[model samples]
Target: MYSRFFSLMGGLAAILSVSGGFGLSDVHAAPRDRDDVFFRSVAGVWKGPGEIVAGKYKGTKFTCDLTGEPLDDKQTGIKLGGTCRVGVFSQPMSAVISQKGNSYEGKFLDGAGGKGLDITSGQVSGDKVVVGINRAKLNGAMVARVSNDNSMNITISVKVADQMIPVIGVTLARDIDQIAVGSIKP
Candidate 1:
């Protein structure tokens, strides 16, 4: 189950890279604005359950615990780390996102070995963020939207052959208890 899920994710990342026209270009940093605001709003710990909506692992359920933290004073960059568990199996996932102007660039590490997936292109519009991922033989995209101050939905999709397949769909809510205790900033 773990292997299949990661494989699909990796493939999706690759596809996203190609489609987004991302290359080995230098990245420039900027200040707070719409993108920064969006990132900051999502900063904190979120926990929820999700399921594989398509492909080989369809119907498989998993629980995810993710934390997003600002990497700079400007809040233009964020480092997210977390884990997803299915039954007794677990997988670690991490991503570093940086915004410049209205665009975003970053890297995603599945923590299942191998190199990080390149987030070639991304944009923050209103309460939504969409990023493209690319790795060797894998390509896909991730979409995240803040439904409210405390809730968000995320979906990942990868290209398989000529078809785009949905791989993961999860809804996460800000961990209220953790917030109240001041363990993580809201």
Candidate 2:
């Protein structure tokens, strides 16, 4: 059961391109995006496969389809909503990350209060956004990186003492519906 939760957490966390946990006291404010350009770059439909790499559910595979929408107005951030499928089971997941003061804050699902994780802290660096996640006693971090406008990679790790153990990895590509072109013979 713990394996399943971690796997899902990783997938859900990845969908938002944000969220995870280090130590409460060790938490530090992540640098804000200059003009919040990172939000704009992740806006789109992303779909791909994920896997649990370590721990009990090693090699467990799943697929996720997530859509990211950059916030309007002066707010700087993005909201992602999607569903992940493992075998015949499908779970709904969502995340919202926005700039708050000099740092970034967000949550996944209902947060720790319900059954989700909280974004304790986050920062945008170049093409990647790394966020700290927490839930009751679980502590870890996740990294989401966007590349070439259509590809993204996300990794979720568990904090162990002084090291972070990677538990999940996902690669999502922009979901584009392609239309085939055909010409009638003259």
Candidate 3:
């Protein structure tokens, strides 16, 4: 089950790359946002169960975790090419990370069949962190945000690909005011 999921993620990364997210011109570039370090520090290993919460997949749940390193060097097309793997999987899936201007993008091979999973587009402003994904199939916004050290939130806006309607929306919010991170592994 694990292999199947990660393999799909890997293939997705490849497709996203081919789709012009990180072309040859962007295969290598310096990390722009300084928050990359902060994000990386909190990125280690995290695992938690999450429910679909909204949309056709609503109520569906999965145990997910994400693990990755900070891309401080000027490298793209999978960052370390073999070292950086983040997401819920036993084996580190191939992740392509690149930075352009003040924003950073990551493409992951969501698994074998060349279908992408959770492609991320995010930016950092001051102590606030905001990230989002526009799924091709789902056709909605999956977004999340975090404050310097006291707050974090995630939201999923349901988008129907077939009819182009938003059926549902879900949001998860927590204040670092209490628990440790209070975050579900992405």
Candidate 4:
């Protein structure tokens, strides 16, 4: 469960990398307005439950507590750090992403070389981000969708032969808010 979920997440394994948003080449120039805004919107503390929906780890459920921070305003990207807990075990997780040229580059944990995956490339379209991930002989994709300012859903999938299979699914909600607002009365 840990290996697969982390591998899947070790994920942002690409999504977070894409969100933390990083680049292989030297990041130059400025990012698009939407890109800038996207990263900023994801900046905050997030927590939620996740499940390994497929493979041998099917039915495995866990939870993660993560915090996201937007990069410098000049750059379009984000960085995420936190821990994922499963039963009595816990793992430290981190991801970084940046925009280089027209694409994005980043990595999860220490990248594919260590215990996490690498963010090869990514693109942000409206409320969601799709990132390419790779680790040794395995190749996959992570998609993160921001349903609203306070919610996000992440899905991680690996390429099997000629198919992309979903392996992990996570739903995150912001845990902290700068200010509380009054509700409207009907």
Best by TM-score: 4
By TM-score rank, best first, the candidates go 4, 2, 1, 3
lDDT of 1 at 43: 65
Candidate 3 residue-wise lDDT at 133: 40
Q: What is the lDDT of residue 131 in candidate 1?
A: 78
The runs of at least 3 residues in candidate 4 whose Cα sits more than 4 Å from the true structure, single-residue gaps closed, are 13-31, 177-186
Regions of model 2 farther than 4 Å from truth: 2-35, 178-186
80-164, model 3: which lDDT tens digit per residue? 1222132333444456555555655655554112444454565544433333344354433333344223223334443454443
Ten residues in sequence with the least summed lDDT for candidate 2: 18-27
> Per-residue lDDT of 87-109 in model 4, one digit per residue for the tens?
88888888888888888888888
Q: Is candidate 1 or candidate 4 better by TM-score?
A: 4
Q: Which of the two, 3 or 4, has more lDDT? A: 4
lDDT of each candidate versus the true structure? 0.62, 0.67, 0.37, 0.73
Q: How many residue pairs clash in model 4?
A: 12
- Would you give me the overall lDDT of model 4? 0.73
Model 1 agreement with the true structure over 114-179: per-residue lDDT tens digits: 556777778755555677777777777787666667776677877899977777877776777776
Once fitted onto the true fold, the runs of candidate 1 whose alpha carbons sit more than 4 angstroms away are 7-32, 110-116, 160-163, 180-186
lDDT score, residue 24, model 3? 17
Better of 1 and 4 by lDDT: 4
Q: What is the per-residue lDDT of model 2 for residues 101-147, given as tens digits with 9 covering 90 to 100? A: 76677788777766788878777665566778888877888887665
